[model samples]
Target: MNANDNIKIDDLKKPYFVWFEENWVHDDVLHHHQKGQLVYVESGFQYITIDEKIYLLPQNHAVWIPPNAVHKTNSHSEKIKLMIMFADIRTKNSFYHKINVFSVPPVLKEMIKYAEKWSKQMTPDHDENLFLKALFNELPRFVEHSLTLHISLPKDQRLTKVIEHLHHHYRDEIKMDDLSDTALLSFRTLERIFKKETGLTLSKYQQMLRIIKSLELLSAGHLTISETAYEVGYKSVQAYTRSFLSVMQFRPTDFIKTIQ
Candidate 1:
């Protein structure tokens, strides 16, 4: 079976294969790869809903989706990507068993780019074969980044009321007086309760929520980068880019380029 047709292990000579594409549109269908797949976006916006956790596939960052993990890729009209599929024994590390993100290390990039070049070379030379095998084993150490902001859904009626308000009005420029009146608690009391329960101040939680929601929208490609930024309460594109790049390693436009 062709690796392009579905995840397959049919080719011995081509134990590792890379598929590079631009302007690809994928329907949101749940699927799993038989082999571990490194889904990297060189540029563009895409969302990978992996095992129920929503992850935005930002530019320059790859989601190291493990074998047998059910996931779906969401895109608008365009996506650009490079996928490296590995066989059973070829992977460099046996320790990693879950999805992870690593910095785009130089060695990894050269290996992939070399592989792309090899594909175009179309030779069956022994040296070329050895280079590919060595490249697979040369896969560098992977580092993971924690993107989750701690949040606690409280059982208290007053705090629940405040939480519900923030959820529904993430776009609004919320004010202290408005939050206090809605929660029916003084600002100080609300602040104290939020800190105790969620480990984040009330303002911090709201900002986190807006950024997370904005990320979701940006991933789906439903809104323009600037428009989505504004929808999540950002007053300007620069403010939005700063927040997005702070959490994710790439700018919004770079992200949009990869998903295409």
Candidate 2:
């Protein structure tokens, strides 16, 4: 799909499903749809911003976006394969109104591939409607494997500056005093407001950012564990490994093996 192309939500007929294998580098403008969307990432990663909360969808995971939720997407990966399934608002199940990330089951993955092929070979009709209904039935199963990593942005301009700085300089050693100065807040105030807004202390939030970025690097398979460690602000490979294991529940090598 063209980066400039915006899918028209109003033009979509009820009980319709369409799929796209996006292989582009673009930052989508903020938009919302009347139909809920299921986005499966076959390879690489995509960052989605919904209602000011950033959710990172890594490979082999899918995100279910509720209808009428404003969101935007940005991808830096050279190869991005995404299959998007649209569900009518009326047919949206209990997953509506919340964004969910889950491990895509093998059955549902095959169903998405089959639906993509079926939609191309046949026009809309009763059989397609039946297929759409079957697809909707399978959606609720995804919630069982939901991954919750709520990375929300602060509304305050001062905190926003700090967050932006962290993203850009996550590779370097970030000090609380420095961040406090950047936000024009004292250390105590910064800690209080950051935890209040994001439910994570400044240090924990920065660690989360490093782990998130490490996933992208490790999944890409271009960097060694030691390189990735220092690249993401960790002083030692062991520390990075422990942090990765604590957050991702797996070793870096194990994660690399899975992607391979």
Quantify all predictions' global Cα lDDT against the true fold. 0.62, 0.77
User: Which runs of model 2 end up more than 4 angstroms from their true locations?
Assistant: 1-6, 25-27, 91-93, 118-123, 224-226, 249-260
List the candidates' TM-scores in order: 0.56, 0.87
Q: Tell me how many clashing residue pairs each candidate has.
A: 14, 0
Model 2, 1-260: lDDT tens digits are 23655545457655666666657445577888877888888788878888888888877778888888888886557798878877776743466668898767777777777776643322467777788787877688656656676578888776988899888987777777888888888999998998888888888888889988887887676888899899898999999999988877767886665454
* Among all candidates shown, the one with the greatest lDDT: 2
User: How much is the lDDT of residue 78 in candidate 1?
Assistant: 54
Worst 10-residue lDDT window for candidate 2 reads 116-125
Q: Give each prediction's root-mean-square deviation over alpha carbons.
A: 7.4, 2.6
Model 2 clash pairs are none
